[model samples]
Target: MSAKALIFYGGWEGHEPEACAAIVEEMLQAEGFDVRSEAGVAVLGEADLARFDLIVPMCTQVSIDQVPLERLCTAIEAGTGLAGFHGGMGDTFRDAPAYQFMAGGQWVAHPGDILDYRVEIAQPQHPLMEGIDDFEYRSEQYFLHVDPGNEVLATTTFDGSHAPWIAGTVMPVVWTRRHGRGRVFYSALGHQASEFTNPQMREILRRGLVWASRTTDSRETGT
Candidate 1:
């Protein structure tokens, strides 16, 4: 059966959330996911939130109601996969520690803002990164507070142009971590939807979503 997936987008329009949502929705549909799209966190509050196999957050810098926040995190813990990219996931739900704990990271700053940088594949032999080579990208190089438990797959180094102290600092640009029974995958790519045009960026997202959505254990647990 096709995996059930929900994508909610809104918050700061500068992130091009709507376009990112549309791009991801199309990607999921093409991958045979039964995709549902919404404009805010409202759908996360649904009584049967656990029904989806995958939950994608495209909303950046938004506040969700307490119950919905708990339900969303609980659903993930119960085996609903969560996958997202860049600020859409990395910089969202600023006030909620639970959300960050579940998602595995939070954006702190992009010292130099948009610029050219190279993404080095940290785990070259990993299946998710198979055939993927380190690539140069021009966008916001995220400096984040990340979960050390995460299996970092890609990294980027800060050159100290914008922030001298952080120069030579290696930061995670892509990672995966488990939250209870769920798989959580994130990539510090996609400042806007157009970044999806890059084959490497597009493929990482495709692989990340597929990897995150296996919820057989959740179904078996009945949680």
Candidate 2:
């Protein structure tokens, strides 16, 4: 059987969650995932979440009920993979530090909001970043509250064009970590679905999803 993936999206509309979910769904489908999509928070509580190999949370600025959030976290701890990009994962629930802990970071600010910035590959040797050179990007330059546990893969230097005090700051752009036994991956890229058209952005997300998923053997053994 193909691997399963669930994408739950909805929250602040300015982030274009619907369009963003569609793009990610298509990407995962192409990757051989038996993809399922849901809008709003209902599915998070109701779905048979443990059956899936991966969970992709795409909600932005939304609050998840405590019971559902706990359930979701338990599933991940039991080895269900979790992965997403930009605010969908990085800035998901402002009120839930537990959610941020699972995802590795929270979006604190975008200094310039939408502007030109550079993304530098920090772990060029990692398979996820291989052949992915540092590139210029136009979007939110995310200032995040990052988890030190994360194995950072990419970083960007702040030029302080918009926020002078932060000039020369080195911030993590991509990382992978663990939520118990479950693997978690995130990239502070893809502020909008359109950005996925950029090969580097798309490839990193694709590889990150694949990387974050449980191995077939682990899934079968319930590990």
For model 1, how does the per-residue alpha-carbon lDDT over 1-223 read when each residue is reduced to its tens digit?
8889999999999999998999899999988899999998888886476889999998899998899999999999998899999999997899999999998999999997899999999998887788999999999999999999999999999999999999999999999988998889999999987899999999999988878886433233211
lDDT for every model? 0.90, 0.88
Q: Give one clash count per candidate, in the order shown.
A: 0, 0
The Cα error of candidate 1 at residue 188, in Å, is: 0.6
CA deviation > 4 Å runs, candidate 2: 216-223
Write model 2 residue lDDT over 77-123, tens digit each, in one string: 99899999888888778899888888888998998799988999998
Clashing pairs in 2: none
Give the top-scoring candidate (lDDT).
1
Candidate 1, residue 216: Cα displacement in angstroms equals 8.5
Instruction: Write down the TM-score for model 2.
Output: 0.95
Provide the clash count, candidate 1: 0
